[model samples]
Target: MSARQRNAAFQAFSWLPHDLRNDNAAVFAVRIKDLGAGVQTCLQLIETSELEREHIRFDGPPAEGDAADVPLLSVTDTSILLRLAITIAGVISEQAEQFCQASEDRLVKARSAATSTGVDHE
Candidate 1:
């Protein structure tokens, strides 16, 4: 992803609840270098909350009556989270592609070396 796109992804994190922020005290705590880790953290939080029968809570669009503690996602929040997830997935896919290409390059080089050394190339 382009730097600008990555930056926008990080900014979308602001839509998340303060409790869900990577670091509640820091503004924009989610960094480009920690994209995968940030996404992982968010996913874990969601999974854990779901398992406990709790929806991720937010401040606004107050829930009706006794549902405030486990408020469901507002339409805006759902859209924002979905978009953020897609952006994160794109970045992760790019990183995986790069890793696979690098691995292939290394294997080709190793095979070349083995052939030259007459070491029974795999």
Candidate 2:
């Protein structure tokens, strides 16, 4: 599906009844570190991989200005980070789908019960 449809599917809980919404608590995975560690983190991501001397491509960093001043990751290293993001987003989408489906089912059952009991379910 398109990204918009995926996003809307992820937010499908908004369409559920209030009672069904109350049954869910969203879960997220988070990483936390002490302050001022962000710069170090970025540096580590790039420096973690070293280009070999025999490499035919990339020719060892750039011949341009300020190689020492730049924080750059090779394509392979950057791909790892991008894949992590995609994996997390996929998890979130799966969670949303399960939650919304369960919620809709619960609401339907609740309404059905109410009607069978001669109660007005508006």
- lDDT leader: 1
lDDT of 2 by residue, 1-122 (tens): 35687567455434445445444442211111211244345445644533332242455555667444333566676667556555655655676678679889999999999999999779
- What clash count goes with each model? 0, 0
Cα-based RMSD of candidate 1: 12.5
Candidate 2 lDDT trough over 10 residues, lowest sum: 27-36
lDDT of each: 0.59, 0.53
The estimated TM-scores of all candidates read: 0.45, 0.47
Model 2 quality (TM-score): 0.47
The reply for model 2, stretches above 4 Å from the true place, is 1-23, 26-67
